[model samples]
Target: MKGFFFFLCFISFSAFCLAQQAYPAAAPLPKKNISIFGRGLYPGDDATYELLKKSGFKTLLLSSFYIHADGDLYSGDSHLPIIHNGKWVGDSAYVVRVKNLKKHSSISRIEILLEGRWYGQPPNTFDFIRDWYDPSKTVPGIVTGIGEQSTLFNICKVLKEVLGADAFCIDDESVYDSPSIIAMGKIAAKLNMHMTLCPFTKYSYWGDILRASDEKVVDALYLQCYDGGARNDIKDWVTALKPQQPIYPIFMVRGSFGTCDSYKGSKSVDEIRAQLKGFKSDYPAMSGASIWQMDDVKKFVSMGCAVKNPASGTATDVAQFLKQLKTTFKREL
Candidate 1:
């Protein structure tokens, strides 16, 4: 009995040591590898990140960095530009918020998602889209013209030096063309910033971008499978794209309030676990997992249509769900 017990102890210790190296830890990480926790926070809702640290979610995908027709930049909810005229023009409050987020938080990595799609806008107006543009146009833009390219390069440099973000994730749902995506990746590399791609449904389009950005240009791919994208199957994606980069599958929460999507939503933590299992079974090579948010805690369990309603969900519920996810990955991998 004693000999067997000692054998079990030795195995346990070895496993623990292995996990320690790969588990979530603070920033300035030693020889950074693919992060296990890749979380997205809505442009204004940062409250959930405080609770999220408990689950070891260290990567913050701060979003909606809005670019303008004139190569200007803004955070989604905050209309004021953070960059302008090839400079970090962020106001005092904006600067403080970013500095404070890094200084007093567990986040070691922060990446802003570029959001520049106007679902229904005139063709003449520069959409701040993913294409080299005609500089003569009245509107300024990103990835277009020599001036626009310079402006984007400056924007990336400022994000690195002033705000201390590591990468830029393109939310180019309405990208003008493929090369523009690659151009953004090249510019990010020139500034020593990692390029991340966030795509839904159009795997072929994103797959091409991923190939162009991998290793030398891009570092991560965040694929969404919810709402209009609910039809996206992880297995199909893996077979089709065969991405060489780490894929951090992102799931839409806010499922309870129909805040994002209701179709195929996980109504409870149990459902989340099951869905995660299914995802893993399909794409076993996934580097990690990302939640679309931390801000949504059980806001409405008893509201909305019964079929579409996640009647008993909360933010803590989401955190607990992540805790389980971390444990499962640790054990399996």
Candidate 2:
């Protein structure tokens, strides 16, 4: 009986050690040159990848992946599961282009963004996490029900194996459940992918997740400095999570809903420069900055979204817009 008890104890200890080993301490934050959101990137053509290869960005965060009912995952506007029952069912072109882009581009890291709330739509991804995450069955560094049969785990696996993703960015706007996010961080760790927080508000909620999980897994914070997060101050976040993890502010350029200056977060190039200067002044160790997306860039050009501030530039093309944005980040911050 004593030997039996010792054997059980040994097994438990080994499991604990294996769990810790699964997610080692996160490495130091990389010095970000520029991280851009690719909302219109997946369906892009060879020209798009060519343009992106020369875009001078270090990270490309594919925006807004959703998990629909019954563990079906979707990206952008496709009505089918990109991953169903642990198999890739989406278009092969996307995977091929992404691989080629990474192989021949300045992009060193590619992250898939799991977002809540889409253009005033329901928060499907967060809802899925809420319903599917079995907190009562969790262990020290991992969660139960996030295994082979789990949709969450399957999606993470496909994103890592198929998409070659380096990390998962959590944009939990509505659901502030720390346990669910911590569970996701652990799952990401299990797949050897890091988890990043994209929080516009609810600093305490994010703080709770960071404190609960290993810092290496939940390594970076991308603060949205646009739209609803227009009033967000960078100093507060820097103060809260500096030296441990790096903080990068994300900005939305002037172009969305076919209006430039009308959008509250939409800023002219000069405005962005000034804002970046202000952020740098507040925190000198600020990691870097990111642009919201590429779809808006096209909308601004095609919809004749005239320059609100003529002094900014006379350029009205997509190339000009991207160039100006890349130049602003390179020169300002």
Candidate 3:
């Protein structure tokens, strides 16, 4: 009886040791948030939304409106449009459209893209005068100057009040003067909205611009990573600017400038993918990546942008790729 009791105790101790060894303590997993930007130029149609859902995207950066040539604001245009279920709704009807989308779709977060004149110029007053003066006459021209500051301020106020946007993206950096950028940041903070500054190149005074803006108000820094030029530029920029700030890397799948230049030698999806894969492998500190202008991707593929084994299917192909990334990385979308 004594021998049997001793044997049972030994067995129990061995089982406990094995259990502790098999189930070693592990570290907590990091949270990953995937966001995509939708250009009003292309508008998020049913197909786009379907792709987003399949790709496991939880947030959308939407282009909401733009300043028109007539010193007036227009909603639905090449730059800004109100799209619902793939249909174009008028600009004045953005609030209703966004509400409906939230109610019907799986979109939880909305970031509005606020665009103005290319170089911080006020809307063209001559165009307004011509349009109002004569119905059948083309507007000649107008000087765009500092009046843009007031116009931008007014536009920001109206957008926050009407659209109830959670965040805003400053699409044009030419207009991002220190004072104007800081003022916009203040307005965003008052309205409880986050701000994203899209810096296309390292030469742009983004660091100074961001510094002028309220640090608490700015949420993320969006770096346009398109060509090899951008790759080197962004890596250096991030290294210099990684001071408790989130950096969002934006990749352009198709565009006029960088896409043509970078992919000229190798004209295949595999080639493009290889370039991106190398970039990610080299620079693993990127917060997240978003592809530029979805329509451009479609256009490129249609225009024979693929290499040897052409990437087939619609934007769905890109979505699947993103989903696979999430699974492989063990990251949340």
Candidate 4:
């Protein structure tokens, strides 16, 4: 009897060890919060900015920081001034307009984007510094080149000093290595800037990026749900990404750009609510919803919220609608 009992105990212990080796412990749940991204590449005046600021989003990401061949970032045609070689340059009126937003807008943090439309051939906005992958290596987190690191650091400093932008959002399609991504994130954080990931692809080290930056300055991951990413299920994304920071699933508004036309924003409060309700059921921990462009906020509000008059005034209706949306999404972490 004693020999049989010992043999059974040994088998049980071995099984336990194997199970532990097979399945790692689950990661801690992500924080709950909301975020927004804006390319600032739209036509408009202060009224446009005013309307967007009024909408309820925690952080406003000013996007399209086009990087040139020489590791320089340009704002393209943003409403805010772009930092170029340590100096902020843009139209004086537009610069003042953006400064006013900083003064009056209720937004808490501002982030600069590192993705944009390609200018032409090599080293354009979209095709800049994409090659950080080394196929010879097994690890997917090592950045082979250090030049991209310097450029990222410079972008961080200029944005922070000139526009008070202490946050950054990277649509990093170039290199998915953990060592390099984590190192770059550390540099940005060291420079007093919060780093965020904009995951729009099925492949790429999304989870690895989160794990590496969990201990560092990575703040949030905004998963793309519009256009090509529209078919991506939120539950699957949450499982795959296992993000450390809050995850805000983003949607699209009707427009004629690249993939913007893929999904169209419509005027049905219940329909929109139903779609988001499904997301809530699947990802109760999600902070909130984000739109692609800045103008989309107003579009969603006007359509879903049913703005009575176009020219008369739409701010009040949009504000009320956004308030309801925010309340629905403020999930406990």
lDDT of 2 by residue, 1-333 (tens): 999999999999999988768563322244765888889776677777777777877788887688776576787645557877557887789888887766767777888898876567875888778767784554333333676556678788888888888888999888788888888887887887798999998878898888888777877889999888998889988676553777888888777656765476777777888999999999887767888887887777776665554643344987777778888888876
C-alpha lDDT of residue 115 in model 2 = 80
Expressed as tens digits, the lDDT of each residue in 1-333 for candidate 1 is 999999999999999998644221213221222233232332333445455445555577766677666766776556677777767776665455555664554556777777656567532112444443334544334444434256556777777777777777776565546666776776665666677877776777888877766464576777776645566667777788787766666665544334434445533444455666788787776556665554333332223322454443332345565565455544433
User: What is the C-alpha lDDT profile of model 3 across 182-235, one tens digit per residue?
Assistant: 555655665556677777654445676566665556767766665433544456
The TM-score that candidate 4 achieves is 0.68
Q: Write the per-residue lDDT of candidate 4 for residues 3-67, one digit (tens) a residue.
A: 99999999999999876442212111233344556655332477766755775556667766666
Residue 248 C-alpha lDDT in model 4? 73
TM-score of each: 0.71, 0.85, 0.61, 0.68
Candidate 3 residue spans exceeding 4 A from truth? 1-31, 40-44, 68-71, 79-97, 100-106, 116-154, 173-176, 202-204, 227-231, 254-285, 300-333
On a 0 to 1 TM-score scale, where does candidate 2 land against the true structure?
0.85
Number of backbone clashes in candidate 1: 11
Question: What's the best-to-worst order under lDDT?
Answer: 2, 1, 4, 3
Q: What TM value does model 1 have?
A: 0.71
Q: What does candidate 3 score on TM? A: 0.61
Residue 307's lDDT within candidate 1 is 41
Q: Is candidate 1 or candidate 4 better by lDDT?
A: 1
Relative to the unseen true structure, what is the C-alpha lDDT of residue 199 in candidate 1, on a scale of 0 to 100?
A: 74
